[model samples]
Every structure is written in C-alpha cells, then in structure tokens.
Target: MAKAVQKIKLSPSRDIPLNKLVLSQKNVRRIKAGISIEDLAEDIAHREKLLQSLYVLPILDPEGQETGMFEVPAGGRRYRALELLVKQKRLAKTAPVPCIIGDMGTEITAEEDSLAENVHRVALHPLDQFRAFQTLREQGRSEEDIAAIFFVSVNVVKQRLRLAAVSPKLLDVYAEDGMSLEQLMTFSVTGDHARQEQVWENVNKSGYDEPYQIRRVLTESTVNASDKRVRLVGLAAYEAAGGNVLHDLFEEDGGGWLQDVALLERLVAEKLRTEAEEIAAEGWKWIEVGASFPYGHDHGLRRLEGVLVDLTSEEQASLDALQAEYDALQAKFEDADELPDDVDVRFGELEEALAVFENRPDIFKPAEVSGAGVFVSIDSEGRLSVDRGYVRPEDEAPAAAFDVERGTDTSSTEGQEAGASVQRAAISVGGASTEPEEDDEDPARPLPDRLIIELTAHRTLALRNALGENPAIAFQAVLHNLVLTAFYRFTSSGSCLEIGLRTPTFPAQAPGLRESVSAKAVEARHESWKARLPKSENDLWDALTALDGGAQASLFAHCASFAVNAVYEPANRYNQGRVSAHGVRTRLDQANVLARAAGLDMVQAGWRPTVDNYLGRVTKPRILEAVREAKGESSAQLIDHLKKADMAKEAERLLDGSGWLPEPLRLADSSPSSAEPEGEAGPLPEFLAGEEDSANGSDEHPQQLDAAE
Candidate 1:
C-alpha cells in the first residue's frame, strides 16, 4: 500500500588533493566550540588516514568548466586540520583527502549540502568510545599511546578504559539503558566481576541502586588511607610491605583506601613497639605500648610533676629575635583586613618557630624516672604520643615509717614515757590522746555541740535565701568550689553549696574520642584558662573576683562542663549500689537539657560510627537499624545477609558521614525519653522531677536558676 522510496543519483565520491581543496564560505559553522582545530590536526596526524569523507563542490572557471579544484562545505574544520599538517610537514601538500563531490545538476545547493552533512551525523555513544579505546588497549596500544593517538589526556584514557573494564553484564545493562552512565562509572572503582555482579544483584534486590550507594557497597571492606593507622605507617612503607591500595581513577579519592586493614594495624603496632623500645633507653620503669591507650588508663596512678627544661642563652636569644620579628610584622599589618599571601605564610612560619621554644619537653629527674613509666601510643593524628612520668601504685615510694624517739630522756621511767608521748604527738595527728592531758580548752569554754548545730542551722537557711537572691554571687560560689576540687589536693569550702559534680573519665577509649574536635576544643579552652589562673588555690578567690563578668561566666561554664555525664551505661537492678536504674535515666535526661542548650551536634563534634567504636560492638540487628535510619531500608537490606562482623563492618562504612547517632548519643528537643517504657527505671527522681517547677520558683527557693547558659 506504500509507494517505493525514491532512488536518486548520489554525489560522486573521489580522492581530492589537499592542495586542490579550499574552505567553502557556505559552511554553517562560525563560532568555535567542541574540539579545537589544533587537536583535530593532531588526531588526523596520529591516524595517518582520514576516517570521514568531506562534503565538497567542484570549483568552476568563468567558462563553467571544472577547474580540477574542490571547495569543502561541511568539513571545513577537517580541511583546516589537513592544511595545518601540510604546513607542519607531517603530511604532503598533495596528500589525497577523501571527499564526496556535490553534483552540479542536483537541486541541492552547496549550503544545503553542508547543512545536511553536519545535521544528519550521529554522535558515537560514550560506551562505544570507551569500548573502542579498550580495543585499542588490547591491541598492544599503551594507555599513553592511546591518549596520544586520540588527542586526549592519559587520565582520560585510563578513566574510559576503567569504564570499559566494568563487568560485561553491567556493561550490557548500561548498553541496554537498564543502568545509567554514572552507575557504570562508579563500577569502574572496582574490577572484580564477581563482586560487581553480586553487588548489582543486591542493589537490584534492595532497590537502592544509587551510584554512591554502589561505591559504598563495593568499598565497604577497605580501610581509608586517611585512617590514623595508615597515616602512621605511610603509603610508601605500606606498599613496600606488599599491601594493596585501591584507587578510583575518576574521582578525588583522598589518596584512596588501604585494602589490608589488618596489615596496617599490625604495622602500626610493630612501629609503636619499636618506638616504645627506643623510649625505654631513657630509663623509664616500664613502657606500656599500644596503638592507642584506654581512656582513664592513668587513673589512680600518680602523674609525676616534671620540670620544663629551661632554655639556654643562645636559644633564648633566637626566641627573642623571632618574637621581635613577628611582633613587628603584626604591628605593620595591624589595620590590614587581609594579609598578603607571603605575609600570611611568614606569620605561620614565625608562629611555628616560636612554638618550638615555648613547647620544650619537660625534664624528669633520674630518681623520679626510676619509679615512673611511659605510655607509648599513636595519637589521633597518627603521630607518636608519649605520655611520660606516670607512677603505678606499687611502684610508688612507701610512706615514711614511724620510729622510736632518738633523743628520749632515758633518765627515768617518767621521762621515757613523756618522750614517747611527745614523739607521738609530733608525728601523728587527730583522735583522742591515749593519756589525759591537762585541761586547756575546758576553761576557754567551747560552745556546746547542740548549740553550735542550732546556731549554724539558722545561718545556713539565711545564707541559702541570700545566695538565691543574688545569682552572680551564687554562680561565683559554685565556681570557686569547683575550682578548689578541680585543682587542689584536699579541698575544703566554707560555702554550704555542694554541687559535687564528679568529672567522670571514660573507661574505654572508644576509638578517636581522645582527639575528637569537641574534646580538643574543650581541652584547649581548659588549658587556656589554666594558664591564666594563679597556681595556688589560696589566691583563687581573689583571682575569681578580679575577673570581668564575661570571664567569670566563661570560668563558670568551664567548671560546669565537668558535671556533664552523658556516658551510656545499662541501667538495671544489678546496677544498684553505685548506679541506680532511676538515677542513670534521670542523669541522662538532664544531660539532654544541657545538650539542647549547648546546641551540641555529635557529627560536628567529630563523632563517626566506626567498626571499633559502635558497629562492631552492637548486634547485627542493631547495626541494620542504624544503617536503615541513616541510609534508608533499601541500603540496610543490602548487607543484611552477611555475618555479624562483616555486616557490622559494612554498616559502619554506610553509616559514616551519615550523622546517625545511637539513641543514647542522640539528643531530643523539649522532652527526651517520652516514648521510653514506663516503670522501666521508675519515675524520674524527685530532684529531677521538681527541676522545672523549681526553675519557675518553688518552696525553699529550689536553688538559683542558671539563665539558659
């Protein structure tokens, strides 16, 4: 029923000499875009042959006869490239350029011919180009050679090769439009066809087949090169030791990932032990070595006070000169809103040079070193951390012994007894005397116990009322007590207020907590304040009063930070004696209020879900729950079939940077634990329950309310 397609005479194809061809003005291309003529020229030279025919018209003389010359219409760029090669002497001027000669008798104009040739051309698919490059590679062309031949960068060639090297099944999926080019590019991150296919099957089953998720699944088992252990060992040493690094060809991989985590950890431990052995030469009692020390490992052990080694004359002179130069530069740039690059860099150099002198290591006496040990470990930055001069209980010097009086009278029994009594009184303290003494305080007439208690009781109540009325004084009083407890050995405060907030240290190090951004910030703040404070506790009261209101508030906050105990410990009947179930819950609930006020973000605080810190410690179900909460149910199901350890490890990779915190570490606004089971830990403690009502004003003026600080 359909008419047959028209059969028309086609243009004659012929080989025209480059010298006979001239660019036609009828060509539609004007503005420069896509590939440059220089690159096209290089490609033509590299190929040694033209791949496509140019559209051309026969040049005519005044008599309307062929002049044996051709004018290119659509392929002007190609003509210019060939002309360039002739000029460069890479190709002969008379080289034959294949072209289609436009028929003069045809209805098509030269302009129409040019437009049709360009408009009707179909661009090669990216996959086809990749496969082509792959073919070239397989045919003994090196990546560099392919790059040179194609007029592209070597990395570009490598990326294309990687994409081509993806699993054949995946490539087919891509070719069939079942998957996207982006997805195929991610597959280029790995070369294991089986693993890639397995991941693809999982991705299909889970329906979370995003490119990033695919990359996560593929690289979950690998260790980040930025990992402290890898950084400590270094890439060169790791590679030299026969460990593999998986690098992504198409992305900024941050130095890629170290595949052998166990090997990395082993290297870290061995290096740490070697460092410890070298440190042993310094005469420490013992050197405890580890990749990282447990939090509170130094607890109960007395840290030795080592004196900073004083600078020599030459060192002092150098430090002074550096300081002078730095100060002069600062004064010169006092009004500068932004320093010049060179000036800024110089400032950093000056600061580091000065810090070297100021941060000199402490020198411990040989006698003290004999009783103290060193803790050799890697810090969170992957640098060797040496915490020296810690004395264990057993290694500590024994208490001074009590002995007989050397100059006892020895004249008579009465004198001997008196000498013994004198020696006991001099060496010992407190408790009732064994023998009665002559009454000295009875005549002075001390107040009766009941009378003293009664008199102080009224004063205590009045003091409480007065303290509540003046928040500033109450705040200062609390700070003073905290300061005494924090810095003094034996603290006794006349103030009746008892915050009794014990600063609890972590029992487990929990991976990177020691050097977390928040922890480091808090420690830096504390150290700055400590440096500004008077060393003696006796001067603390005067110093506290001397500070400005802002400084006073800051000091109060620093003291209050010690009271924050957000550490998660299971609450149950067995947790009695020390941590009651109710008490633990109430403490955490209060911590939530504080957390909300502080606008605390665990993610910004450098808390990440890692295998060592969280995932490895939880059950498989819990791991899936975390992943599901962070990356959706589809992602969670992707690794659900793996063993607990493997699942946890993979879940850790998925959860990293997801900013997902466990329930204990999570913060809720307004009311936390509202959905928690009732009677699980009984009602909130009376003090905690009344806290809100107290803030609004209750009986006994329930402590001064901190104004949302």
Candidate 2:
C-alpha cells in the first residue's frame, strides 16, 4: 500500500533564516548536520555577494498540519546568510526572515532536485562534477543522459567516468586541492591503487614544484603492459626500493643506481673472448726479423714460406736450368785469355773452349804476373815478334819507324814493364798525328741535333718564385699562352716536328691550374672587390662625390675601366652597372645628397635621417619612473631645487598605516574596505574630522587624526 503524499506550500520569499524557521531534525541531519558551520557561513556570504538581490521562504505539510515549509530553490545560501545575520545580532530577535518550503522525499530525489536547481546557477569544482557524474552512472544513467544532465559532451562524461576509477586516496587529494585531469587519466591506465597512491604521495610531497616531475619518474620506472595492476605494483616496489636491486647482487659494495655495470662488464668480456677464439682459429703469428738492411721491411716472409711450400715440379726444373746456364758462363770466363783472339768467334769454338776450360780449367788460367809480360813468337835469330802483351822496361825500345798500337795491360807488373818501351813509342807517334785526328773529330761537332735548352739555376729559381707568388697568373701566362700557342701551331701546321724540339706540355697538363684560376677570378670579382661597394645609397653617394667635377670624371673613367676589366669581361658583359660609368654616376649622386645633408665634411658628419625624430621625444624621467615602479619604489621631487627627495620613509609609512589613503594595491586581494562588515559600525571619536561625538563608548572607535597632527 502506497502512503499518501503530503502537499507542502512554499513561500515566495527567497532569503530565510534557517535558525528562526522550524525544520525536521531528520531533514536537518541529512542536509546540514555534517557540514562545518563555518563553511556554510562562508558559502552563504559568497552567494549573497554574488547575487545582491535575494530572498527566502518556508515549507508546509499536506494535512494542513504544518509538517514543514519549502523555500524558493535559490534560497539555500540566503537562508544560511540570514542565520548568520541572526547569530551576529544584526537583525532583531522578533524580525521575520523570508523562506519557501517543500515536501521531503527519498535521498535520490532530493539530490536530483538539489543538483538540477544548482547546476545552472553555480559553478561546481571539476572533481565534484566528475563525482556527481559517477554517482549518476551508478544510478543506471547512460553516458548521453549524464552528459545532457551536466550540459557537457558525451566524451567529457565518459572521461569523467574513467577518472572516477582513480585511487580514492588520490581522488581525495584532487577534491581538497586541484590537480590535472590528464595526470589522473594517466594514473588510471596503470590501474594499481598502490602505484597511484605512491604517485600521489610523491606529487603532493613535491609541493607541485614542477608538473612534469611526476610523469618523468613514472615513465622511467614502468613499461606499458596490459596487466597494468601487476606491472604497476612491480614498478612501485622498484621505485620504492630506490632502483638498487641489481646493484645489491652484482656489486661488492652498494653503488648508487648503477646496477647494470655487471651486465656491461659481462658483455665486454664475452666480446674479448670471441675475439681471442677467432685469433686462435686463424693462427696468427708474429715474426721478429732483428737488425737487417732496409729496416722493418717484412719482405712478405709468410707469403714466401707459403710459395716455397707450394712450389711445383716445373718451377724446380726451371730453377735447375738457370743454375746450369750460370755454371757454363762461369766456366767460359775461367780462362778467357786462353780463348780465341778472333773477335768473330763461333758458337762451336766457344762451346769447345768452355768444355776444355771445364775439363782442365787451371791450364787456361793466366798467371797473375806483376808489372809486365810479353807473348812473343821467336825465330832462330835473336829477333822476337810480339802478340798481345804489356811493355816491359827490360825490352828494347821499339824503332821510331815501327808503328806500335797501344793495348790494355792484363798481366801483373812484370808483363807491364816488358811493354812500357812499346807504349812510349806509341804515345810519341800519336802526338805526331794529333792534327789529322782533330780534323776527323770536327765533323762530329755539328750543333747537337737535339738541343737541350736547360734554364740557368738563377732563371729557374726566378720562374719558381713567380709561380709561387701567384700560380694562377703564372700558369695562365706561361702554360696557357705559350704551350697552347705552340700546340695550336703544331696541330694546325701539319708539320712533323722532332720530339725534342716540340714545346713542353707538362705545365699545361698541371692539375687544378685552369680551374683554380677561373674560380679565384670569379671569387675576387664577386666577393672580395665587389663586396667593398657601399650597401646603402648615402654611403655610395658619399664615396663618389668627394671629388670636383673634372676629378670626378677622371675617377669615373678609372672606375669604368676597372669594372669593364673585372665585372664585365668575366660575366660576358651582361651586367654592366656592376663596374660601369653609370654606376660611378649613381655613386656620385648619393655622395652629393650625403654631403649636402652633413656639410662638406661628409666623411666625419655621417648621414642624416629623412624621417622625423621619434627617439628624442620619449621622456627619460618617465622611463626611470617605470623602472622604479617595476622595482617597487616611489619617489618625490624638490620642485625648487629640481632634485629627487628621499621618500623611502614616506613610502614605508604609507604601506604600514591606513589613513586618508588606503594600503598600496596588492595582487591577491582587493581593497580592504570592500569586504563585508562582520559587525555594526563602531561609535565615532572626537578626534575624527567628521565625527563630533561617540554613539557608544571610547572602546567602539579609536581616534583618527588630521594631517596637521
């Protein structure tokens, strides 16, 4: 059976004193019992300040039994304010307070009404709003409905719902003090209460010094994983233990945060072991060839050893043949003097001599006789005919008529003395025939067929110096001009010039010569020289017009010549102003304007501004004042002396005391006079300028003084 609903009449007034009005103890306990009275008072004051025109009313029962009264829905704060006013004795005890009342219902319906009424009229804190949303969702409300109720996007509702799952402890902090929703969402992804609690503790402990510190600590500690709970708990433990577990196991003594040192050491040791194994498998060897010529030259000993080990039979046979040939040559040379005197000896005679020499090599060998020896054929008469031999001192001198041919002495001293007399006769005859030999040698002296035109040492040094001074210019003048000209003549003339008489091509073929010269010329013209031109019109003009008209024309001509030689020729004459006569004229015009503005001493005076002087009008005093003001300073001036006065004391006094002027402005709070008066106005004192008498007593008000006092 359904109980009949009570009909309660609501008052039209919006402001009601909750103290004066009767309310059910049950409703009072549900609404205001747990709330701090001081907080209620503050809220009431705030609401009253926000809405100056406000009122309240009462509620009644349907039995006409006056169970309760309902105030207009906007009067909650007003009722609280009225209660405060009554408590403070601002309103008389008998004075009526306005209110409207309504019937009671279930807690949910009451909460719905409260939320609906207050949602549009007041701004709730975001966390409170999110919690409200969660409560609605728990009551079987869809995301869309929750969003509509709160007048927010569905995504915003969903986001708030997600945040609701954040650790209750962290949520409590969020409620008491504001925190970023993004940070809460990030923590939620971990889904670990302990981890979230740790994060919250760290953040709170940091006193919100830097927002990124929390995220940085978390990201460095954790990895992304689907089982966020286990991962988060592990991460929390890791961070809480100061990230030193691995260090404890691997390090002898406690090392701070360097737990991976053992891992790094293990890796390096493994790499070294691998390298050692490879070296062993590859059979590396070191050879020390001590103290030899061509020092430190290895001569590829290892390669040589390999080749010796791998030699084939054919190579061995070839080596044997080479040894045999060497032996045969040695045998023939053993007694070369005993061999044939005929210059045109056959292969057969050479072989026979070689074989005989090989058989009895000692017989053909010539005795090492000193001085001179004679090979002579003697007849029955005491006359001797000589073969090839040295002259001896004991031998009689040859007759003056005997034509003796001198021959090289191959024997020792005894043989040389035997041939000395013949040699002296030969020398004397040669001297007598010197005139004929000169005439015969004269034909051999026709100007050398190949002239070796070598430069003198000094001339070569000078040429090298010139090249070093400017290789580009020297190369162009010497190689490009002379060598190219000679090459052109040779190629076009169709003449078969001798190789020695041909011009040298070495200089022309030198690397980087032509390209370097071109690059240097282009760079000098564009960068080094052209960069000297004035960047501004005034500077350009000043440079040009420094001379008289005749002098200017001469200067212009010089400039034009330089420009034509530098800018025009290299650039193909396409951009003439770069170094042209007209460019000189433009520079002259600029100079004239500059000279007129800055007087004839234009070089010293510099250029004048065409625009008005905006810089001069900005007040120096105002700028100084602005700086002083930024530094929290004040100043006064002695007008007659035109000097600053010491106002530090006066400024301090103004800051400390309140009189005709209020305290200096502050950033965080408004003027003190703007706050609501907590009590009734106190009685005025006689010392006050406008006040004549005290309405209460001396305790009610303190004395105010005139400026003269």
TM per candidate: 0.64, 0.19
- For all candidates in order, the CA lDDT equals 0.65, 0.34
Candidate 2 per-residue lDDT, tens place, 574-601, comes to 4454333444333334323322322222
* TM-score of candidate 2 versus the correct structure, residues matched by position: 0.19
User: Which regions in candidate 2 have their CA more than 4 angstroms from the true location?
Assistant: 1-125, 178-186, 203-209, 221-709
**Residue 297, model 2: Cα distance from true site in angstroms:** 34
**Tens-place lDDT digits, model 1, residues 478-513:** 665567667863532222234665455442233443
Clash count, one per candidate: 0, 54
Model 2: lDDT equals 0.34
- Say which candidate scores most in TM-score: 1
Deviation of model 2 at 630, angstroms:
31
